[model samples]
Target: MKRFKHLLPVLLLLMSLTAAIISCKKGGDDPTPTPTPAQPVTTITSISPATAPVGSTIAIGGTNFGTSPTSNTVTIGGVVATIVSVTDTQIVVVVPTGAANGPVSVTAGGQTAQSQSTFTVYVAPLKPVVEISGTTFANQNWTRDKIYLLKGLVYIPADFTLTIEAGTVIKGAAPDQDPDKKNMAGTLIIERRAKIIAQGTASQPIVFTSAKAAGQRAYGDWGGLVLIGKAAMNTTSTAALPGGVRGTVERYAEFNDNSGTLRYVRIEYAGAAQPTGSATRLSGLSLYGVGNSTVIDHVQVSYSGSDSFAWFGGTANLKNLVAYRSFDDDWSADWGYVGNVQFGVAVRDPDVADQSGSNGLELENYDPTATTDVTPVVLANGLQQTAPVFANLSSFGFGTTPTTNKSAKGTGAYLAGLYLRRNAAVAVYNSLLYGYPEGVSLGATGATPGVTNNTIDLQGIVLANVLTPVVGNGVLTSDLTTTYFTTSGRANQIVQSSDLTALRLNNFNATTPGFLPQSGSSLLTGAVTGGKLANSFFTPTTFRGAFGTDDWTTGWTNFFPQNTDYDR
Candidate 1:
């Protein structure tokens, strides 16, 4: 009975030890870690830079991207991208050349992920180097997006039209180093019967500038824009007109010839002089016999080497013309020009001038020769009259005092406010000529008989702060003042007075200038109120100057051409 009891106690102890071992196994050591839920299949959330061109790097954002780049394969637009970097939540890859618009897919491990949105691929336009030199027979259209690099002398022949789209930019390269060619400057010429339909808006205006970098651009960087038409121009050349005759040519056009339009256009850093020619110098915008039907409004010519705007025997009227820092004349008319100009403003640089003679308005009836006589009665081309009417012209020069002549008079630069010579029959009205060495000079080669009869007819002209208000080189000064200035209709001639406080010109001599008259200025209401320019072609405004209640040159004008990036 003692042996049986001992065995039962031993059995009980063994059973208790077995229960303790079972409890320890149930509470210790993890059970296979649950496999981490398979990481949710590594979903893709989005892609950065939804649209990109070829060769651009795009980023893919998602969850659970593999750490190794080789493990993750990203394809954009069905083309495999070169994976640059990879992380757990993002991947950056370069777009391949053959990429198109499609959903970007990423494949890692045994799973594949696709972006919810499709990526866009933009095809860049091919920038072709258009070398336009010869004549164009058919219509030529220059689009806005394409970049045109102008080569040598590009001319539009007769009966053709060159249509430049709005916001189009035309750049001229540097002059070629051709020794044989006198002037290898690039020039765009529109021959008679040819037209340029460059109609730009206030927001998207056409730009003509140098191809050089902005800070490297300068005056005379390239040749200017030239438009030649079949309009009446009284030139001394009896030989047959090279382009065409106005009355007898095959496609003879009159003053109302529609030579297309040039609106809201900016011509910068132009006016390169030809090496050898009768017209050696070129202006920013040269109109050779451009008829009245041609539209030229809101045109800004800045940093011109020669005249800003010159009309060589054309009746095309201009308005809202801004001539900024021209090296030579601001507005010039020659070859029997009879066009009417209104609302023209010219701001001159104190140090810039030409040795030949620079003036605010240089009117010559005909080409001057040593043998030509200065007779006003003599008609130009023996048929036409050299009468060009100018109204509401605000010519601002660089002079502090009445006799402050900063420019070199005889050697470097000759200064004049209004140079009426060469039998020029110019009528100035409602004009302001301020700060000039010589205000108004008549007769370049000394006055002859009947000089004052047809030379100048001044009315409502303000010659303020001028060294010499009215003077004649060879004619009697008394006779000039009596015949031209002291007429019954002539009035309001201001000279050397401090009363010019009304003209609120901002930085008149600086690179950036503003010519808008301030409030309470006399220029706002001093204009003729009878609608002086109420013709069909002109829009009548009560204000006298180019800028009035509305600043037309606000949006498109670029005052600082030196800093602009033409390529951008």
Candidate 2:
């Protein structure tokens, strides 16, 4: 009976265990189920030729490319991309044609791969090459599709010739704000030993002017025309041709006897400034220490703010130079310019001028310590004077600068007709000095040495309505010359006192005509050159005054006069 009881207990235990196992099995068999394989995601990875040409073939890379996308498809920009070929993990697409040289992108299966906006198609510019050989301009037809740039001190190779077609405009560049960088506008530096055969006739004369429009034109609009030659000039340095060529400013080593020729050419406003403190200020034409081998004839410099022509101590010969309405001194040569000039004229503006405005010529030696080697700048057959004497000198007297002394006169040394100071020794003859506050004042600074051996042989010279006598210590005149201290030619005259505190003179207006030499204006006939009169002064036969002849009035006009203010 006990064994039977133990067996029953065992059976009950076994049945309970079985019931627990069944419960666990029932819980495991609930409604939850595992998922089947999912559809793969589509995406774009990369593009080739990060920067490709417009017509180049490009490739696109990506994964899970669809055959016919319903909501998302591969595209570039907004245009749907044509899938040349597609695989399970990649898609090949050709770049679109006629695409701009800008950024490109690839979009596939709602994913995008982009190239930045700065990225562009690569295309090289076709540069026009110029090859000069055998001392002659060989590439005559090279400028067809090219622009010329005279970069970084270009040496006009010796025995090399540069011939440009008519009506060609060349711009200059110089580092203004930054000399180290490309700050300079442009510059054409004609170095020593280099010859340029730039010839222009009167009928079809060559023009060198600013690129700006007439109304907006200005002086120093661009860099100046720097001609470096081995010439003689009046300067303090014992060495000839003081300022050297290019960056080397020294005495001339070998005197170049080949005089550069410039005829029937008109250079408009030029004279762009270079680096700060640079001696260059953009004179219409800058002759840096050239020699007598240079010839400047039949050239017109109009509306230039600076001196029309600046010679830095060179022995160049000038014939028929016209200075029409230059703001500063008409002709400036210093540092030993021992050159000879004939048939030169200076014209002044009644208005639209500055205190620095001068009628005839100015010469000087900026250096105070250099040894003296004086060479006289000779001038003949010219009318060197201010316009007409305005009764009210207020309008014409140094027009603007209150501090400027209109009554001052000298060889540019003091202030007037022939100002020769800073030890500058110059000689002048057969020129008229009229309508000046002071005829001639010499030795500006008490310490500054006066002009030595300088002669002014004024034959039939007219001195009309001047503040002071034409015969100053600086002016050495003979009996043949007439000096009228108190005289009047064209009315409306004014005079200032020595105190220089008040303005004096009479009704000077815009309409007041300066000295206008008539066609038969006595000055037309009597010009004794070397000794014999030349038929061509500026045009046909020596005419009169500074601009003895007129080329524009005859058949041409519309010369782009330079602006008085080059910087503005």
Candidate 3:
């Protein structure tokens, strides 16, 4: 009986286990109902804007992205990206910080899709960046902590204001490396009526530089800063000058219209040329149709591939400008620029010059500087003449000492101090120009800008070491230089090169040379506030050629940007 009882307990245990198994089979084991069909593989077809900097929005186009944004997850370079919007076929996501170069991946409905092509991510800022591209529709403020990398032709449309904090650094990314980008440079264009309130302090000047590293930076690494406004210009079409970049046009004139403020700013290693067919390279700061109300002061342009500063059809007044080692002209004005410039300096390198001839002021009314510019008899569209007043300019071109090859890339000829051709009506007072082929090369048959006409006025000038003080370059014979420029009450002096030695500008030929006038030098004397300088636009100063005892370009200017740690 006891044995039977033990067997009965064992049998009861087996029967209980069998019953549990049968119940489970009936409840949950119903033929493993047709397996839920695998989710459609999320296929990535394309990625628009394949290249992007950190903190930029990019589109991921594909299929199988769920309609709800929460259901989809996107990652760039393995870093999680914020999904801005999502659709079944497309997903828009903002490239998050810390993103690196990698393939983009998206996950939706338990299915995943990855891009076959690698996404290029650029982050060349000191710490981080907010990249700017295309056109700025809304008002934006750029801070100083992060360097803004301009990806393409960044435009600030009219009425939109770009407020830049002091000490901000903006880099123009070179587009020559990427064949997909259309433009060869990253340019900043302030369209007509657009405003840029960039008022930097002397200690913390705004800097616009190339994206290359310190040692790798060179001339034309990227594009320059351009300001286009509404102001009177000499040309009917204003297409002659490159103020609107390569082939863009300058629109109707609106005198005294404000563009914006550019004070205590530095634009370094700029002036990159346009794509293939462009004949002209961009300038460091090109003002097109800018108005006098736009303030431009204490601006330094160093290592420019082309001109440091250029104006086309504008009345924009600029002062305290420094043009250091430019490839082309230091200052250029054309297409009826009637602005006022004072307290400017041009430091030329005998080793650096352009094929078109590098000079201090390359003045012209339009593109054609030949005798075809006989419009001196009649103005274009009844606009004002190109009569910009320049005062206290020290254009020191030491061309005699080294006897340079002139051009950086190819062989080029040494030009002049002020090459005034075409129909230019300019007025210069209290300036020093030295060490070129000629101090002032006057050409093109023009009656309005001639000395007899009084429109081409040179009130006070110190001409030294030039092969010819004043000469008609090829077409025009300047009778005024022999009879009026030297003999008249213009206070113009033709000093010998030895006089500059007493100035004590030690090692002025070097890359980082001293440029302060010593005590008892003749260049420090003979400044006047009479004649054309009597106008209110002129700031009355006792010193003559741009500097006397103080070097205004000391703290803010970077003479050796080749080695500067811009990221610091």
Candidate 4:
């Protein structure tokens, strides 16, 4: 009985303690407290770009998308988007391509309002913009007669007119075929009568050269002007040519007929030679059968190999030409050429000569046996001479006398600046000649019959030289320069003023002599008038020098510095 009573008292004490604890729990005074409402899921954090570029992934942020995520999906304007990542408060989804550019609303729930915000996608550009990586043309394929330009070079098919803006710079490409043939160069082959108005002013001259040029690049590093004309090609009745069998003729009718005008153009550092000798070498501007309707004026050829300007057989009329520092002949005429050129100047390096190295002009009848009568060419006020200096044989090794030091087949034979051979007839008058082995040679091999009746009349011609003075042959005598060269040995030098008045009909005052009548000048007031010339052709009276007066002192000078030691 005593033990039972003791146990009952103990149970009563424990019950009292339990009852106190239960009261405390009922009064909300428990030790373990509830978390404060989890900060009410209010003020949602920021979403990483509710708007972004197409194909971009965007982040969505909010209070509890769902602790367990019963359903998780994102949509932009009701369009289902891919969910790249998901978190308790954020979801990342990818914007699809072709997605409309507009304010996009992102939603996560159906019933409950999800965190919605406006987003946008950027639109892509349409045109292809050129960058440092190179030119990126937008519409490469143009409709019929449409003109397209990528980079600076204009690519046109047949029967298309490519209108180029004035002062546009067209860079030639590096040689694509036979790199070792020295055929590594680029070219512009204008087909038929496709007009190309590439005319630039003296202030803004159009430049056609290599990308390596700081101001100017090395000469002959690339091919030059290539104009394919519809005037005439090799004879159809020639039996000597491979394709010109007597019965099978390659007529001129097959050439493309695209006529164009190349006025006030300057071609520099062109005419790279191939392994097939200079015959295959590309000229600065190769006008192949260009029509006589085309106009070529105020063109300058600087630092080139082969001929600066070569006319295969085109009736294009050319005037005001300047050929400076050309490795080969400055001007060359071949095949069926019927053009009249006036006020042409040829300046050659003193180190070179005529026989295989020097000649101011070269006229040739390509198909000697062909009966297809080729047209005649007229040249007036054309100057082909330069001052004499020590023969820098090494500089002319590859161009002037490649065969002198090296074997004939080993290197190559250098041609002259001017070589009139192959039974071709040409007329020249009132010009200047300087240091050259032969100022002008009539025949090439044997007694050529072309020069017998041909007229090469000269009135006031000047031949100047430092080392070996000019020695004129044929009807042209060394006494032509007596009026200009006042110096003892230079008494025969022609005056610039005389050349101006005698060549063209421009009023060049004694004060503003242009390139003529300058004090102590080689060419003073002396020239053949238009009526006096065999062909009554008139041109501007800017003294016949390689450079214009402004080019030397003022204007945007494209001075090609002579520092070849450094790799361009």
Candidate 5:
């Protein structure tokens, strides 16, 4: 039994070894089974915003998009979309132009998948733009099919003409804030003997504005327009033309020179866009030696960073002029301007003013820096003092509450409705001045003969909500009230009333302003009877203000330009 037991242990160990060899066998008869390859899982689960305009970005959620953006190719509506970013499960892309309604597809790695839903693409309505720069040496015509973009200063040389069609839009390029870009602010200068025939209708007035996105436009976005001509100018002293344009006496200017016509035009953000960084200051519209043959009517200048309208030594006449939200003076006439203007309105902003004083009308004749005093006729230039005439003007200043002068100014000049200085020999009739520190200012610039010698006459002047009816330096209030304002023939009154009661304007909102006078308003009556209305230059009407029932600013004027999406 002992011998058999010993043999059984050896036989058990041998059987175990044989079984291990059999279990670990890797021979050809039992070769390893071939491994199966895994299938790719590239897919597009969902696409956000089934429909979008071209250039709009959208996101797509899926599986196996891969981490590398270069390996992913996304297409919307069969158009290849630019992949903005990519992740393993989501991809963001910008819709491509000319894309149509089709499935959103994404090809990742070696596999491609598409979203179940289709993506619709639409075209956004946009205005086509044309850029213009430098000088205009030849006659040019601007049409309405496209918007013209003015880049930097544009000059019209002598003998050239620029014809702007009705409903045409001219936009100034964005101010190149970089100091390296000098004189890059958009400006138009019509040199002497040059002409600009921009005659628009009331239904489709031409528009000049800033080329900026909506809500980003402001005063001084670009430079303004200037017109110079060979018109007669009587100046004994230095003249400050619009945008610092100077009047020369190299030759006698003709009185009958035809400058051009500008009617039914709206200028927005057209003024000194202060490029304190590099460029010169600008004005809304500057006329240097412009003659009476030039036609300017129904023109609105809004958001001017400098003077709205300035005429230096010329017999240029204008009617139906509107100055809104100007940062400086509205109407500035200097250096013997002997023209006639009627039906003008100036509305001031409560928040803005100029550093050189803000006034509705700033009239001057001679510069004190040039000469001490002047006679009517001077031998040097055969020049006389300023003697322009104006009627039916409305100047709305600060609110009834006293203004705190939010703006700065040199010369310590105060805010006034009318500023007459430096022997300004002129006349104003049937004018309305409202809401100002001084309704009529005189002698502030050391004037002597104009107010006292009866050269400067003001008749039918209606002042409402004015702090002071007549105020100036070195002038008695009683003398001004009794001599000029309270005469029997003149109908001048200083009353305290609101805009709704005195003018009854339809709308006075800052952005969308309306200056038409309605019924039950004081502006409907009390016009000059026979004094200046009998003149050929004046429109014979009983209305005391610029507007009477007829809304002159209805059709083409855009008061809400701040919210207008011009490029969209």
Candidate 6:
């Protein structure tokens, strides 16, 4: 039919070119496949506080968290926190000072997300509640899981240091009963060249109580620990320390002034009384003029109303001292304290006294009619006149009788058990004055020319159950115990407390007693052995007085400071 009309226009142009190649492959193939973005899954699912503390601020929540907090990150416990605010379902960070306890990831876009459990980072068994006060001078540490909080006269001034780490606990406050605010006492003053590392061990010590609250605490309730150094003093000129109480004068630091370390410390229920004069108090450690590189070992001044480790002038050389239950004077030195103590331990509580008479070592010098006159201040300060060289002392009093009826005329008016008097120049070795009424008083009745020119050295002492073992005001009577057992060099006993019941102490009026010393004890063989304490700050212990068969005041001494729990 003539090729069927030429193939009917070529079959209609090949079916219109196959319908234009199927309409250009159904409208240009595959250039629109770019809608697949949904991979940003950074989930965390709730993290409000699962513990949080290292500078707290948690709150993580859930989901993507990547609307763009710079595409988010977070970490925590792997540390990197500090992200403040992020969105896409919340983020808020900051728990990174050393963020410890684990998993809290949360990446974003790159997709990370951890938190399902394990966050727990609030480790402060005490920290936070820092407070302090005034003058500092930078470098101040205090960490052992902090408690700090002094709040009044906290000064450190003159080239500061103040470290304090080993299990610290500070606390102070309370005591503004407004006697014009009583100098606002909460004291910590270190002044002078200021320094106080406060090392502590014997199982973590460093405490300092009185934020009152634990049997409502007592005794002055705060304001104590004052250091103030410059080494030499015998009144006059360094503003005559003592009642003039000058601490921050700003110079003088010699006698080996390194003013730092104080190992295994504990000073509970501090002093606080000095608002103005009279028996001017403030002590449980007030070492003005501290030096000799200042270390002071294993200290513990408990329940002191005043004077329990005082030293208006210092050469600073204490060692394992522990004066518990002191109202006043359990080791007090004055105007010219040339230090060197060793293993001291005083325990007294016949219902506390302190009308200027509580004694167990209350030395003094520099006041031959003061206004600065101790012979031109010891001939223009070559110093060394308030002597202070006790060794291995262990004084425990209150036992003439009365377990608690109290007043044996106010405990025989200030229970003297080693009082040494105003023109003092002491040195007692291997001591152990027990259960006293009076056992070693000397001069002080108008001082008697400083008891005929100072020098009261007693050796290897052991006056027990003393009613009056050596009194001397009409100038050293009983011939000063026959000149302290024939010229102060050999043994010197006066036993009677039931011939010294092996001194297993345990109840010198309880409250954690147990001043050790029992297995065949004659104080473990009358100490003072051959090499007589071979110097180098004497540590030669054949056993005598201040405990010797272990028990260096056991696990950081805190004889139930009114049931301790200074915020745990």
Choose the strongest candidate by lDDT. 3
Pick the TM-score winner.
3
TM-score of 4: 0.52
Could you give candidate 5's per-residue lDDT for residues 1-568 as a string of tens digits?
9999879989999999998888787453776789998876988888887778876789999999878779999988888989998899999999986788999999988888988888878655776887887776799999887888887777788899999999888988755832237655777778888899999999888888988877899888888788887665665323333353333433445666677999999888977554343324677887877888999999999888778888877778899998888888889887677788998888877667776678889887756543323564242363656778889888887654546455443322337788877666668888888778777877623434555655677877887767666775544243664466677677887776544366675656776667777778777888776754566878887888677777677777776688665564
lDDT of model number 1:
0.73
What RMSD does each model have against the real structure?
Answer: 11.7, 22.0, 19.3, 20.5, 15.8, 22.0
- Candidate 6 residue 171 C-alpha distance from true site, Å: 11
| Alpha carbon lDDT at 197, candidate 4 | 61
- Where model 1 places Cα greater than 4 Å from the true spot, the runs are 1-129, 177-182, 237-253, 367-382, 402-411, 444-455, 476-479, 486-488, 509-511, 529-542
lDDT by residue for model 6 over 246-270, one digit each (tens)?
4433335377887788888999888
lDDT accuracy of residue 176 in candidate 2: 46
Residue-wise C-alpha lDDT for candidate 1, range 523-558, written one tens digit per residue: 666554333345564555555556666766687787
Error of 2 at 216 (Å): 2.4
> 561, model 5: CA deviation in Å?
0.7
lDDT of 3 by residue, 476-505 (tens): 576755556686577888876666575445
Give stretches of model 4 more than 4 Å off.
1-155, 176-184, 213-216, 234-250, 253-258, 274-278, 351-355, 368-418, 444-452, 455-459, 466-517, 520-522, 530-537, 540-557, 561-568
lDDT score for residue 147 of model 4? 19
How close is every model to the real structure, measured as TM-score?
A: 0.70, 0.53, 0.73, 0.52, 0.72, 0.31
Q: Give the Cα-based TM-score of candidate 5 against the true structure.
A: 0.72
Ranking under TM-score, best-scoring first?
Answer: 3, 5, 1, 2, 4, 6
